[model samples]
Target: MATQLPVINLMGPTASGKTALACELYARGNYELISVDSALVYQDMDIGTAKPTKEEQQLYPHHLIDIITPLEVYSAAEFVTDATALIDQIHARGKTPILVGGTMLYFKALLEGLSDHLPSADIHVRADIEQQAAEQGWESVYAELQRVDPQAAIKFKPSDKQRIIRALEVYRLTGEPITQLQAKQVKNQPYSYAFQNYALLPDRAELHARIELRLQKMWKIGFLNEVEFLMEKYDLNDNLPAARSVGYRQALDFLQKSDRSLKNKAVMEEKSLFATRQLAKRQYTWLRSLQQTHQFNVYLSIEQAQEDLRNLYG
Candidate 1:
Protein backbone atom coordinates (compact mmCIF):
# COMPACT_ATOMS: atom_id res chain seq x y z
CA MET A 1 0.00 0.00 0.00
CA ALA A 2 1.24 3.47 -0.92
CA THR A 3 0.76 6.58 1.15
CA GLN A 4 -1.48 9.22 -0.39
CA LEU A 5 -0.33 12.73 -1.14
CA PRO A 6 -2.05 15.57 0.72
CA VAL A 7 -3.98 18.39 -0.87
CA ILE A 8 -4.31 21.32 1.50
CA ASN A 9 -7.37 23.56 1.72
CA LEU A 10 -6.90 26.85 3.55
CA MET A 11 -10.31 28.33 4.26
CA GLY A 12 -11.48 31.38 6.19
CA PRO A 13 -13.64 34.49 6.10
CA THR A 14 -13.00 37.69 4.10
CA ALA A 15 -10.48 39.32 6.42
CA SER A 16 -8.97 36.18 7.91
CA GLY A 17 -5.29 35.46 7.45
CA LYS A 18 -5.69 32.47 5.14
CA THR A 19 -3.82 34.14 2.30
CA ALA A 20 -0.97 35.27 4.50
CA LEU A 21 -0.64 31.78 5.96
CA ALA A 22 -0.67 30.25 2.45
CA CYS A 23 1.98 32.71 1.31
CA GLU A 24 4.17 31.90 4.30
CA LEU A 25 3.83 28.19 3.53
CA TYR A 26 4.68 28.84 -0.12
CA ALA A 27 7.75 30.81 0.91
CA ARG A 28 9.12 27.63 2.46
CA GLY A 29 9.15 25.89 -0.98
CA ASN A 30 7.59 22.64 -2.30
CA TYR A 31 4.10 24.17 -2.30
CA GLU A 32 2.03 25.62 -5.11
CA LEU A 33 -0.78 28.11 -4.42
CA ILE A 34 -4.12 27.77 -6.16
CA SER A 35 -6.68 30.45 -5.46
CA VAL A 36 -10.21 29.23 -4.69
CA ASP A 37 -11.65 32.75 -4.73
CA SER A 38 -14.52 33.63 -7.09
CA ALA A 39 -13.60 37.29 -7.31
CA LEU A 40 -9.85 36.85 -7.82
CA VAL A 41 -10.52 35.06 -11.11
CA TYR A 42 -11.22 38.38 -12.81
CA GLN A 43 -8.39 40.23 -14.52
CA ASP A 44 -7.71 43.87 -13.59
CA MET A 45 -10.11 43.72 -10.65
CA ASP A 46 -7.20 43.59 -8.29
CA ILE A 47 -7.63 46.40 -5.78
CA GLY A 48 -11.03 45.43 -4.40
CA THR A 49 -10.38 41.70 -4.43
CA ALA A 50 -7.42 42.21 -2.14
CA LYS A 51 -5.40 40.37 -4.74
CA PRO A 52 -1.75 39.66 -4.15
CA THR A 53 0.55 42.36 -5.36
CA LYS A 54 2.32 41.74 -8.67
CA GLU A 55 5.65 41.41 -6.91
CA GLU A 56 4.29 38.94 -4.37
CA GLN A 57 2.78 36.87 -7.18
CA GLN A 58 6.09 36.92 -9.05
CA LEU A 59 7.92 35.64 -6.00
CA TYR A 60 5.24 33.08 -5.10
CA PRO A 61 3.12 32.26 -8.10
CA HIS A 62 -0.56 31.44 -7.55
CA HIS A 63 -2.57 29.59 -10.15
CA LEU A 64 -6.18 30.48 -11.11
CA ILE A 65 -5.83 34.18 -10.48
CA ASP A 66 -6.68 36.60 -13.31
CA ILE A 67 -7.78 33.73 -15.56
CA ILE A 68 -10.96 35.42 -16.81
CA THR A 69 -12.34 38.81 -17.77
CA PRO A 70 -14.83 40.67 -15.63
CA LEU A 71 -17.62 40.09 -18.17
CA GLU A 72 -17.24 36.33 -18.00
CA VAL A 73 -18.99 34.07 -15.51
CA TYR A 74 -16.93 31.52 -13.60
CA SER A 75 -19.01 28.88 -11.95
CA ALA A 76 -18.18 26.54 -9.06
CA ALA A 77 -18.49 23.59 -11.42
CA GLU A 78 -15.75 25.14 -13.52
CA PHE A 79 -13.69 25.74 -10.37
CA VAL A 80 -13.87 22.04 -9.43
CA THR A 81 -12.66 21.05 -12.86
CA ASP A 82 -9.84 23.56 -12.87
CA ALA A 83 -8.75 22.82 -9.32
CA THR A 84 -8.71 19.07 -9.85
CA ALA A 85 -6.52 19.54 -12.88
CA LEU A 86 -4.21 21.89 -11.01
CA ILE A 87 -3.90 19.45 -8.13
CA ASP A 88 -2.72 16.76 -10.51
CA GLN A 89 -0.29 19.07 -12.26
CA ILE A 90 1.22 20.36 -9.05
CA HIS A 91 1.62 16.85 -7.66
CA ALA A 92 3.31 15.76 -10.84
CA ARG A 93 5.73 18.65 -10.41
CA GLY A 94 6.58 17.30 -6.93
CA LYS A 95 4.80 20.10 -5.11
CA THR A 96 1.77 20.04 -2.83
CA PRO A 97 -1.24 22.11 -3.88
CA ILE A 98 -2.61 24.65 -1.42
CA LEU A 99 -6.14 25.82 -2.23
CA VAL A 100 -6.89 29.04 -0.42
CA GLY A 101 -9.80 31.51 -0.44
CA GLY A 102 -13.06 32.63 1.16
CA THR A 103 -15.38 31.38 -1.57
CA MET A 104 -17.11 28.58 0.30
CA LEU A 105 -19.27 27.59 -2.69
CA TYR A 106 -16.17 26.80 -4.73
CA PHE A 107 -14.74 24.83 -1.82
CA LYS A 108 -17.99 22.91 -1.38
CA ALA A 109 -18.27 22.15 -5.07
CA LEU A 110 -14.74 20.90 -5.15
CA LEU A 111 -15.23 18.78 -2.05
CA GLU A 112 -18.48 17.26 -3.34
CA GLY A 113 -18.84 17.01 -7.07
CA LEU A 114 -21.88 18.66 -8.61
CA SER A 115 -24.73 16.51 -9.87
CA ASP A 116 -24.36 15.62 -13.54
CA HIS A 117 -28.12 15.36 -13.84
CA LEU A 118 -28.54 19.05 -13.03
CA PRO A 119 -29.10 21.19 -16.09
CA SER A 120 -26.48 23.62 -17.25
CA ALA A 121 -27.19 27.31 -16.75
CA ASP A 122 -29.49 28.68 -19.45
CA ILE A 123 -28.49 32.22 -20.36
CA HIS A 124 -31.85 33.22 -21.72
CA VAL A 125 -33.59 31.66 -18.75
CA ARG A 126 -31.22 33.40 -16.37
CA ALA A 127 -31.74 36.67 -18.19
CA ASP A 128 -35.49 36.22 -17.82
CA ILE A 129 -35.02 35.50 -14.14
CA GLU A 130 -32.87 38.61 -13.73
CA GLN A 131 -35.48 40.63 -15.55
CA GLN A 132 -38.06 39.25 -13.20
CA ALA A 133 -35.89 40.19 -10.25
CA ALA A 134 -35.49 43.69 -11.67
CA GLU A 135 -39.15 44.26 -12.46
CA GLN A 136 -40.46 42.46 -9.41
CA GLY A 137 -38.20 41.90 -6.44
CA TRP A 138 -35.99 39.18 -4.96
CA GLU A 139 -38.73 38.60 -2.38
CA SER A 140 -41.07 37.64 -5.22
CA VAL A 141 -38.42 35.40 -6.77
CA TYR A 142 -37.75 33.77 -3.43
CA ALA A 143 -41.49 33.35 -3.06
CA GLU A 144 -41.48 31.53 -6.37
CA LEU A 145 -38.71 29.29 -5.09
CA GLN A 146 -40.66 28.59 -1.94
CA ARG A 147 -43.75 27.78 -3.98
CA VAL A 148 -41.91 25.54 -6.40
CA ASP A 149 -39.11 24.06 -4.27
CA PRO A 150 -39.84 24.67 -0.65
CA GLN A 151 -36.94 22.50 0.49
CA ALA A 152 -34.46 24.56 -1.50
CA ALA A 153 -36.13 27.84 -0.58
CA ILE A 154 -35.65 27.10 3.09
CA LYS A 155 -31.90 26.89 2.53
CA PHE A 156 -31.55 30.45 1.30
CA LYS A 157 -32.72 33.88 2.32
CA PRO A 158 -34.38 36.27 -0.15
CA SER A 159 -31.20 38.33 -0.15
CA ASP A 160 -29.36 35.28 -1.50
CA LYS A 161 -30.37 36.28 -5.00
CA GLN A 162 -27.72 34.18 -6.73
CA ARG A 163 -28.65 30.83 -5.16
CA ILE A 164 -32.39 31.65 -5.25
CA ILE A 165 -32.21 32.36 -8.96
CA ARG A 166 -30.17 29.20 -9.51
CA ALA A 167 -32.68 27.05 -7.64
CA LEU A 168 -35.55 28.54 -9.62
CA GLU A 169 -33.63 28.10 -12.86
CA VAL A 170 -32.96 24.47 -12.02
CA TYR A 171 -36.61 23.93 -11.09
CA ARG A 172 -37.83 25.60 -14.27
CA LEU A 173 -35.46 23.66 -16.52
CA THR A 174 -35.79 20.18 -15.05
CA GLY A 175 -39.05 20.33 -13.10
CA GLU A 176 -37.15 19.10 -10.04
CA PRO A 177 -35.97 20.72 -6.87
CA ILE A 178 -32.33 21.79 -6.87
CA THR A 179 -32.06 20.22 -3.43
CA GLN A 180 -33.22 16.86 -4.83
CA LEU A 181 -30.76 17.10 -7.69
CA GLN A 182 -27.99 17.99 -5.25
CA ALA A 183 -28.85 14.98 -3.08
CA LYS A 184 -27.99 12.73 -6.00
CA GLN A 185 -24.49 14.17 -6.37
CA VAL A 186 -21.64 11.73 -5.99
CA LYS A 187 -19.41 12.52 -3.02
CA ASN A 188 -15.92 13.26 -4.32
CA GLN A 189 -13.47 11.22 -2.32
CA PRO A 190 -10.05 11.36 -3.89
CA TYR A 191 -8.67 7.89 -3.44
CA SER A 192 -5.10 8.86 -4.27
CA TYR A 193 -5.01 12.06 -2.22
CA ALA A 194 -6.22 13.23 1.18
CA PHE A 195 -7.58 16.68 1.93
CA GLN A 196 -5.92 18.37 4.90
CA ASN A 197 -8.15 21.32 5.69
CA TYR A 198 -7.18 24.35 7.77
CA ALA A 199 -9.70 26.88 8.99
CA LEU A 200 -8.85 30.34 10.40
CA LEU A 201 -11.74 30.99 12.74
CA PRO A 202 -11.20 34.36 14.38
CA ASP A 203 -13.54 35.77 17.01
CA ARG A 204 -16.45 37.79 15.53
CA ALA A 205 -15.44 41.13 17.01
CA GLU A 206 -11.83 40.57 15.97
CA LEU A 207 -12.89 39.58 12.46
CA HIS A 208 -15.18 42.61 12.20
CA ALA A 209 -12.38 44.89 13.23
CA ARG A 210 -10.13 43.37 10.57
CA ILE A 211 -12.84 43.80 7.92
CA GLU A 212 -13.27 47.44 8.89
CA LEU A 213 -9.54 48.14 8.68
CA ARG A 214 -9.18 46.24 5.39
CA LEU A 215 -12.01 48.14 3.69
CA GLN A 216 -10.71 51.44 5.02
CA LYS A 217 -7.35 50.58 3.48
CA MET A 218 -9.05 49.61 0.24
CA TRP A 219 -10.75 52.99 0.05
CA LYS A 220 -7.45 54.70 0.83
CA ILE A 221 -5.75 52.85 -2.03
CA GLY A 222 -8.29 54.01 -4.65
CA PHE A 223 -10.76 51.11 -4.54
CA LEU A 224 -13.50 53.40 -5.88
CA ASN A 225 -11.25 54.54 -8.70
CA GLU A 226 -10.51 50.92 -9.54
CA VAL A 227 -14.22 50.15 -9.70
CA GLU A 228 -14.76 53.22 -11.89
CA PHE A 229 -12.07 52.04 -14.30
CA LEU A 230 -13.51 48.51 -14.45
CA MET A 231 -17.03 49.84 -15.06
CA GLU A 232 -15.82 52.01 -17.91
CA LYS A 233 -13.57 49.33 -19.39
CA TYR A 234 -16.07 46.49 -19.29
CA ASP A 235 -19.25 48.51 -19.81
CA LEU A 236 -20.43 46.88 -16.62
CA ASN A 237 -23.97 47.01 -15.27
CA ASP A 238 -25.39 46.31 -11.84
CA ASN A 239 -26.62 42.90 -13.01
CA LEU A 240 -23.16 41.58 -13.92
CA PRO A 241 -21.63 39.09 -11.46
CA ALA A 242 -18.44 41.09 -11.03
CA ALA A 243 -20.40 44.28 -10.43
CA ARG A 244 -22.41 42.53 -7.71
CA SER A 245 -19.36 41.48 -5.68
CA VAL A 246 -19.35 42.83 -2.10
CA GLY A 247 -17.35 46.05 -2.32
CA TYR A 248 -17.83 46.58 -6.02
CA ARG A 249 -21.62 46.44 -5.73
CA GLN A 250 -21.73 49.10 -3.05
CA ALA A 251 -19.20 51.21 -4.92
CA LEU A 252 -21.29 50.90 -8.08
CA ASP A 253 -24.34 52.12 -6.20
CA PHE A 254 -22.35 55.01 -4.79
CA LEU A 255 -20.81 56.00 -8.11
CA GLN A 256 -24.10 55.81 -10.04
CA LYS A 257 -25.58 58.37 -7.70
CA SER A 258 -25.96 61.92 -9.04
CA ASP A 259 -24.42 63.31 -5.90
CA ARG A 260 -20.99 62.16 -4.67
CA SER A 261 -21.59 63.90 -1.36
CA LEU A 262 -19.47 63.02 1.67
CA LYS A 263 -22.58 61.69 3.33
CA ASN A 264 -23.23 59.42 0.39
CA LYS A 265 -19.59 58.28 0.46
CA ALA A 266 -20.00 57.53 4.14
CA VAL A 267 -23.11 55.51 3.37
CA MET A 268 -21.20 53.56 0.70
CA GLU A 269 -18.44 52.81 3.18
CA GLU A 270 -20.94 51.70 5.80
CA LYS A 271 -22.80 49.47 3.35
CA SER A 272 -19.66 47.91 1.97
CA LEU A 273 -18.41 47.14 5.45
CA PHE A 274 -21.75 45.64 6.38
CA ALA A 275 -21.79 43.49 3.26
CA THR A 276 -18.23 42.27 3.96
CA ARG A 277 -19.11 41.37 7.56
CA GLN A 278 -22.19 39.58 6.24
CA LEU A 279 -19.96 37.70 3.84
CA ALA A 280 -17.81 36.64 6.79
CA LYS A 281 -20.89 35.49 8.67
CA ARG A 282 -21.88 33.31 5.71
CA GLN A 283 -18.37 31.93 5.54
CA TYR A 284 -18.53 30.98 9.19
CA THR A 285 -21.79 29.19 8.46
CA TRP A 286 -20.10 27.25 5.69
CA LEU A 287 -17.20 26.43 7.97
CA ARG A 288 -19.58 25.05 10.55
CA SER A 289 -21.32 22.94 7.95
CA LEU A 290 -17.99 21.71 6.63
CA GLN A 291 -17.00 20.81 10.17
CA GLN A 292 -19.97 18.45 10.40
CA THR A 293 -18.34 16.18 7.79
CA HIS A 294 -14.69 17.11 7.44
CA GLN A 295 -11.96 17.53 10.03
CA PHE A 296 -9.97 20.75 10.05
CA ASN A 297 -6.84 21.98 11.79
CA VAL A 298 -8.50 25.06 13.19
CA TYR A 299 -6.62 28.13 14.27
CA LEU A 300 -7.80 31.40 15.74
CA SER A 301 -4.69 33.32 14.83
CA ILE A 302 -2.00 33.44 12.15
CA GLU A 303 0.71 32.60 14.68
CA GLN A 304 -1.05 29.36 15.49
CA ALA A 305 -1.37 28.51 11.81
CA GLN A 306 2.28 29.26 11.27
CA GLU A 307 3.27 27.11 14.20
CA ASP A 308 1.20 24.17 13.04
CA LEU A 309 2.34 24.35 9.41
CA ARG A 310 5.95 24.81 10.52
CA ASN A 311 5.75 21.54 12.43
CA LEU A 312 4.07 19.83 9.47
CA TYR A 313 6.53 21.04 6.84
CA GLY A 314 9.69 21.43 8.86
Candidate 2:
Protein backbone atom coordinates (compact mmCIF):
# COMPACT_ATOMS: atom_id res chain seq x y z
CA MET A 1 0.00 0.00 0.00
CA ALA A 2 1.29 3.46 -0.82
CA THR A 3 1.60 5.75 2.17
CA GLN A 4 -0.41 8.95 2.01
CA LEU A 5 2.04 11.60 3.15
CA PRO A 6 0.78 14.40 5.31
CA VAL A 7 1.06 18.13 4.59
CA ILE A 8 2.48 20.48 7.20
CA ASN A 9 1.45 24.12 7.16
CA LEU A 10 3.33 26.91 8.92
CA MET A 11 1.32 30.07 9.09
CA GLY A 12 1.68 33.38 10.92
CA PRO A 13 1.78 37.16 10.54
CA THR A 14 4.61 38.94 8.68
CA ALA A 15 8.09 38.64 10.30
CA SER A 16 6.80 35.61 12.19
CA GLY A 17 9.62 33.35 10.94
CA LYS A 18 7.48 31.05 8.75
CA THR A 19 10.19 30.86 6.08
CA ALA A 20 12.90 30.15 8.62
CA LEU A 21 10.97 27.26 10.15
CA ALA A 22 9.93 25.91 6.74
CA CYS A 23 13.54 26.10 5.59
CA GLU A 24 14.75 24.25 8.68
CA LEU A 25 12.22 21.47 8.11
CA TYR A 26 13.15 21.24 4.42
CA ALA A 27 16.86 21.00 5.35
CA ARG A 28 15.95 17.96 7.41
CA GLY A 29 14.33 16.42 4.28
CA ASN A 30 10.89 14.88 3.66
CA TYR A 31 9.29 18.12 2.54
CA GLU A 32 8.89 20.53 -0.37
CA LEU A 33 7.91 24.08 0.54
CA ILE A 34 4.86 25.35 -1.31
CA SER A 35 4.08 29.06 -1.12
CA VAL A 36 0.54 30.21 -0.49
CA ASP A 37 1.53 33.87 -0.59
CA SER A 38 -0.09 36.06 -3.25
CA ALA A 39 2.77 38.55 -3.36
CA LEU A 40 5.64 36.07 -3.54
CA VAL A 41 4.08 34.54 -6.61
CA TYR A 42 4.90 37.72 -8.54
CA GLN A 43 8.27 38.03 -10.28
CA ASP A 44 10.71 41.02 -10.04
CA MET A 45 9.44 41.72 -6.54
CA ASP A 46 12.33 40.36 -4.59
CA ILE A 47 13.89 42.23 -1.65
CA GLY A 48 11.00 44.56 -0.86
CA THR A 49 8.62 41.66 -0.35
CA ALA A 50 11.27 39.82 1.67
CA LYS A 51 11.19 37.00 -0.82
CA PRO A 52 13.70 34.25 -0.16
CA THR A 53 17.12 34.82 -1.74
CA LYS A 54 18.46 32.84 -4.70
CA GLU A 55 20.83 30.90 -2.41
CA GLU A 56 17.94 30.07 -0.11
CA GLN A 57 15.81 28.92 -3.03
CA GLN A 58 18.74 26.78 -4.23
CA LEU A 59 18.94 25.14 -0.83
CA TYR A 60 15.35 23.93 -1.11
CA PRO A 61 13.31 24.32 -4.23
CA HIS A 62 10.22 26.49 -3.69
CA HIS A 63 7.04 26.19 -5.72
CA LEU A 64 4.66 29.00 -6.67
CA ILE A 65 7.04 31.90 -6.07
CA ASP A 66 7.88 33.76 -9.28
CA ILE A 67 5.19 31.81 -11.13
CA ILE A 68 3.65 34.99 -12.54
CA THR A 69 4.49 38.59 -13.30
CA PRO A 70 3.11 41.51 -11.32
CA LEU A 71 1.10 42.48 -14.38
CA GLU A 72 -0.83 39.22 -14.19
CA VAL A 73 -3.41 38.77 -11.46
CA TYR A 74 -3.19 35.59 -9.39
CA SER A 75 -5.96 34.17 -7.27
CA ALA A 76 -6.51 31.70 -4.49
CA ALA A 77 -8.54 29.46 -6.79
CA GLU A 78 -5.55 29.16 -9.12
CA PHE A 79 -3.20 28.61 -6.20
CA VAL A 80 -5.35 25.80 -4.82
CA THR A 81 -5.46 24.07 -8.20
CA ASP A 82 -1.72 24.31 -8.88
CA ALA A 83 -0.51 23.56 -5.34
CA THR A 84 -2.71 20.44 -5.10
CA ALA A 85 -1.15 18.94 -8.22
CA LEU A 86 2.35 19.72 -6.91
CA ILE A 87 1.57 18.13 -3.57
CA ASP A 88 0.26 14.98 -5.24
CA GLN A 89 3.44 14.67 -7.28
CA ILE A 90 5.58 15.17 -4.17
CA HIS A 91 3.65 12.43 -2.37
CA ALA A 92 4.25 10.06 -5.27
CA ARG A 93 7.97 10.76 -4.88
CA GLY A 94 7.72 9.69 -1.20
CA LYS A 95 8.04 13.23 0.14
CA THR A 96 5.92 15.45 2.33
CA PRO A 97 4.19 18.58 1.12
CA ILE A 98 4.66 21.58 3.40
CA LEU A 99 2.56 24.64 2.69
CA VAL A 100 3.78 27.85 4.27
CA GLY A 101 2.52 31.41 4.12
CA GLY A 102 1.01 34.36 5.96
CA THR A 103 -1.84 34.79 3.51
CA MET A 104 -4.83 33.62 5.56
CA LEU A 105 -7.38 33.84 2.73
CA TYR A 106 -5.25 31.63 0.51
CA PHE A 107 -4.79 29.11 3.32
CA LYS A 108 -8.53 29.05 4.08
CA ALA A 109 -9.42 28.60 0.43
CA LEU A 110 -6.98 25.71 0.19
CA LEU A 111 -8.27 23.96 3.32
CA GLU A 112 -12.05 24.53 3.61
CA GLY A 113 -12.68 24.74 -0.13
CA LEU A 114 -14.19 28.00 -1.27
CA SER A 115 -17.13 28.28 -3.63
CA ASP A 116 -15.93 27.47 -7.16
CA HIS A 117 -18.00 30.31 -8.53
CA LEU A 118 -15.54 33.01 -7.50
CA PRO A 119 -16.25 36.45 -8.88
CA SER A 120 -13.85 37.35 -11.65
CA ALA A 121 -12.32 40.77 -12.14
CA ASP A 122 -13.72 43.12 -14.75
CA ILE A 123 -10.93 45.61 -15.37
CA HIS A 124 -12.97 48.09 -17.34
CA VAL A 125 -15.72 48.25 -14.74
CA ARG A 126 -13.20 48.40 -11.90
CA ALA A 127 -11.36 51.22 -13.62
CA ASP A 128 -14.63 53.12 -14.03
CA ILE A 129 -15.43 52.64 -10.36
CA GLU A 130 -11.97 53.82 -9.42
CA GLN A 131 -12.37 56.85 -11.62
CA GLN A 132 -15.73 57.57 -10.02
CA ALA A 133 -14.20 57.06 -6.61
CA ALA A 134 -11.43 59.51 -7.43
CA GLU A 135 -13.83 62.17 -8.66
CA GLN A 136 -16.81 61.67 -6.32
CA GLY A 137 -15.17 59.99 -3.32
CA TRP A 138 -15.95 56.69 -1.55
CA GLU A 139 -19.45 57.61 -0.32
CA SER A 140 -20.64 58.23 -3.86
CA VAL A 141 -19.20 54.89 -4.95
CA TYR A 142 -20.96 53.18 -2.03
CA ALA A 143 -24.19 54.93 -2.99
CA GLU A 144 -23.82 53.54 -6.51
CA LEU A 145 -23.13 50.10 -5.10
CA GLN A 146 -26.22 50.35 -2.88
CA ARG A 147 -28.39 50.91 -5.93
CA VAL A 148 -27.17 47.58 -7.35
CA ASP A 149 -26.34 45.60 -4.20
CA PRO A 150 -27.84 46.83 -0.97
CA GLN A 151 -26.80 43.68 0.85
CA ALA A 152 -23.19 43.94 -0.29
CA ALA A 153 -23.23 47.65 0.55
CA ILE A 154 -24.30 46.74 4.07
CA LYS A 155 -21.28 44.42 4.47
CA PHE A 156 -18.77 46.80 2.89
CA LYS A 157 -17.51 50.08 4.24
CA PRO A 158 -17.42 53.09 2.00
CA SER A 159 -13.65 53.23 2.46
CA ASP A 160 -13.18 49.64 1.25
CA LYS A 161 -12.29 50.68 -2.28
CA GLN A 162 -11.19 47.24 -3.49
CA ARG A 163 -14.28 45.30 -2.43
CA ILE A 164 -16.58 48.14 -3.42
CA ILE A 165 -15.05 48.23 -6.88
CA ARG A 166 -15.27 44.47 -7.12
CA ALA A 167 -18.94 44.51 -6.11
CA LEU A 168 -19.61 47.10 -8.78
CA GLU A 169 -17.71 45.01 -11.31
CA VAL A 170 -19.78 41.95 -10.48
CA TYR A 171 -22.93 43.98 -10.97
CA ARG A 172 -21.76 45.21 -14.36
CA LEU A 173 -20.73 41.74 -15.58
CA THR A 174 -23.72 39.65 -14.43
CA GLY A 175 -26.46 42.24 -13.80
CA GLU A 176 -26.77 40.61 -10.35
CA PRO A 177 -25.31 41.44 -7.01
CA ILE A 178 -22.09 39.48 -6.37
CA THR A 179 -23.34 38.54 -2.93
CA GLN A 180 -26.26 36.65 -4.45
CA LEU A 181 -24.05 34.75 -6.88
CA GLN A 182 -21.54 33.87 -4.14
CA ALA A 183 -24.42 32.73 -1.96
CA LYS A 184 -25.38 30.18 -4.62
CA GLN A 185 -21.93 28.66 -5.21
CA VAL A 186 -21.38 25.01 -4.47
CA LYS A 187 -18.54 24.04 -2.15
CA ASN A 188 -16.55 21.21 -3.72
CA GLN A 189 -13.40 19.46 -2.58
CA PRO A 190 -10.62 18.75 -5.06
CA TYR A 191 -8.24 16.70 -2.87
CA SER A 192 -7.75 15.78 0.75
CA TYR A 193 -4.57 15.71 2.83
CA ALA A 194 -3.85 15.66 6.54
CA PHE A 195 -2.93 19.20 7.68
CA GLN A 196 -0.57 20.15 10.48
CA ASN A 197 -0.94 23.88 11.01
CA TYR A 198 0.83 26.37 13.28
CA ALA A 199 0.72 30.14 13.84
CA LEU A 200 3.80 31.80 15.39
CA LEU A 201 3.06 34.90 17.43
CA PRO A 202 5.57 36.61 19.64
CA ASP A 203 4.52 38.56 22.75
CA ARG A 204 2.40 41.63 22.07
CA ALA A 205 5.20 44.00 23.01
CA GLU A 206 7.70 41.86 21.14
CA LEU A 207 5.52 41.79 18.05
CA HIS A 208 5.07 45.56 18.07
CA ALA A 209 8.81 46.09 18.46
CA ARG A 210 9.55 43.57 15.73
CA ILE A 211 7.07 45.24 13.39
CA GLU A 212 8.78 48.59 13.86
CA LEU A 213 12.22 47.07 13.37
CA ARG A 214 11.22 45.22 10.22
CA LEU A 215 9.62 48.28 8.68
CA GLN A 216 12.82 50.22 9.30
CA LYS A 217 14.82 47.40 7.78
CA MET A 218 12.60 47.44 4.72
CA TRP A 219 13.21 51.17 4.27
CA LYS A 220 16.93 50.68 4.65
CA ILE A 221 16.93 47.90 2.04
CA GLY A 222 15.69 50.24 -0.71
CA PHE A 223 11.98 49.60 -0.19
CA LEU A 224 11.45 52.98 -1.86
CA ASN A 225 13.59 51.92 -4.78
CA GLU A 226 11.73 48.66 -4.96
CA VAL A 227 8.44 50.50 -5.15
CA GLU A 228 9.84 52.79 -7.80
CA PHE A 229 11.14 49.83 -9.74
CA LEU A 230 7.70 48.22 -9.53
CA MET A 231 6.05 51.37 -10.81
CA GLU A 232 8.54 51.64 -13.63
CA LYS A 233 8.70 47.90 -14.21
CA TYR A 234 4.98 47.15 -14.11
CA ASP A 235 1.68 48.83 -14.91
CA LEU A 236 0.78 49.09 -11.23
CA ASN A 237 -0.91 51.92 -9.45
CA ASP A 238 -2.45 52.74 -6.07
CA ASN A 239 -5.54 50.71 -6.90
CA LEU A 240 -3.77 47.41 -7.43
CA PRO A 241 -3.51 44.92 -4.56
CA ALA A 242 0.26 45.17 -4.71
CA ALA A 243 0.25 48.93 -4.16
CA ARG A 244 -1.92 48.52 -1.03
CA SER A 245 0.63 46.20 0.56
CA VAL A 246 2.27 47.28 3.79
CA GLY A 247 5.25 49.62 3.48
CA TYR A 248 4.66 49.97 -0.23
CA ARG A 249 1.95 52.57 0.17
CA GLN A 250 3.90 54.68 2.59
CA ALA A 251 6.96 54.25 0.45
CA LEU A 252 4.78 55.53 -2.36
CA ASP A 253 3.68 58.44 -0.22
CA PHE A 254 7.23 59.30 0.65
CA LEU A 255 8.35 58.79 -2.91
CA GLN A 256 5.61 61.06 -4.19
CA LYS A 257 6.62 63.75 -1.69
CA SER A 258 3.10 63.68 -0.36
CA ASP A 259 4.36 63.98 3.17
CA ARG A 260 5.25 67.62 2.73
CA SER A 261 4.02 68.27 6.26
CA LEU A 262 6.81 66.14 7.66
CA LYS A 263 10.04 67.90 8.46
CA ASN A 264 12.34 64.93 8.12
CA LYS A 265 12.61 61.36 6.83
CA ALA A 266 12.28 59.94 10.38
CA VAL A 267 8.75 61.23 10.64
CA MET A 268 7.89 59.49 7.40
CA GLU A 269 9.50 56.32 8.70
CA GLU A 270 7.39 56.50 11.89
CA LYS A 271 4.20 56.89 9.88
CA SER A 272 5.16 53.91 7.75
CA LEU A 273 6.02 51.94 10.89
CA PHE A 274 2.64 52.72 12.40
CA ALA A 275 0.93 51.65 9.21
CA THR A 276 2.87 48.36 9.23
CA ARG A 277 1.86 47.69 12.84
CA GLN A 278 -1.78 48.33 12.01
CA LEU A 279 -1.40 45.91 9.12
CA ALA A 280 0.06 43.31 11.49
CA LYS A 281 -2.90 43.71 13.84
CA ARG A 282 -5.32 43.13 10.97
CA GLN A 283 -3.36 40.07 9.90
CA TYR A 284 -3.36 38.63 13.42
CA THR A 285 -7.08 39.31 13.76
CA TRP A 286 -7.84 37.59 10.46
CA LEU A 287 -5.63 34.59 11.24
CA ARG A 288 -7.25 34.19 14.67
CA SER A 289 -10.64 34.43 13.02
CA LEU A 290 -9.71 31.64 10.61
CA GLN A 291 -8.53 29.51 13.53
CA GLN A 292 -11.88 30.02 15.26
CA THR A 293 -13.90 29.43 12.14
CA HIS A 294 -12.03 26.31 10.96
CA GLN A 295 -10.92 24.91 14.32
CA PHE A 296 -7.36 24.48 12.97
CA ASN A 297 -4.70 23.91 15.63
CA VAL A 298 -2.16 26.70 16.23
CA TYR A 299 1.21 26.95 17.98
CA LEU A 300 2.91 30.08 19.26
CA SER A 301 6.51 29.19 18.60
CA ILE A 302 8.63 26.79 16.62
CA GLU A 303 9.46 24.87 19.79
CA GLN A 304 5.76 24.60 20.55
CA ALA A 305 5.19 23.62 16.93
CA GLN A 306 7.88 20.97 17.23
CA GLU A 307 6.13 19.62 20.33
CA ASP A 308 2.83 19.50 18.46
CA LEU A 309 4.56 17.74 15.56
CA ARG A 310 6.04 15.13 17.91
CA ASN A 311 2.60 14.35 19.29
CA LEU A 312 0.91 14.31 15.88
CA TYR A 313 3.33 12.21 13.80
CA GLY A 314 5.71 10.67 16.31
Which of the numbered candidates is closest to the native, going by highest TM-score? 1
Candidate lDDT scores, in order, read 0.89, 0.76
Clashing pairs in 2: none
* Model 1 segments more than 4 A misplaced: none
Candidate 2 stretches greater than 4 Å from native: 1-5, 188-190, 257-264, 310-314
Give the distance in Å from residue 10's predicted Cα in candidate 1 to where it truly belongs: 0.9
Using lDDT as the measure, the top candidate is: 1
- lDDT digits (tens) for residues 5-119 of candidate 1: 8899999999898998899889886899999999999999998999999999998799999999988888888888899999989999998999999999888888877788888
Residue-wise lDDT of candidate 2 within 135-221, one digit each (tens)? 988888899998999999999888777788878887888888889888875553545576667777766677787677777677677
Q: Residue 306 of model 1: what lDDT?
A: 89
**Where does candidate 1 have its weakest 10-residue lDDT segment?**
185-194
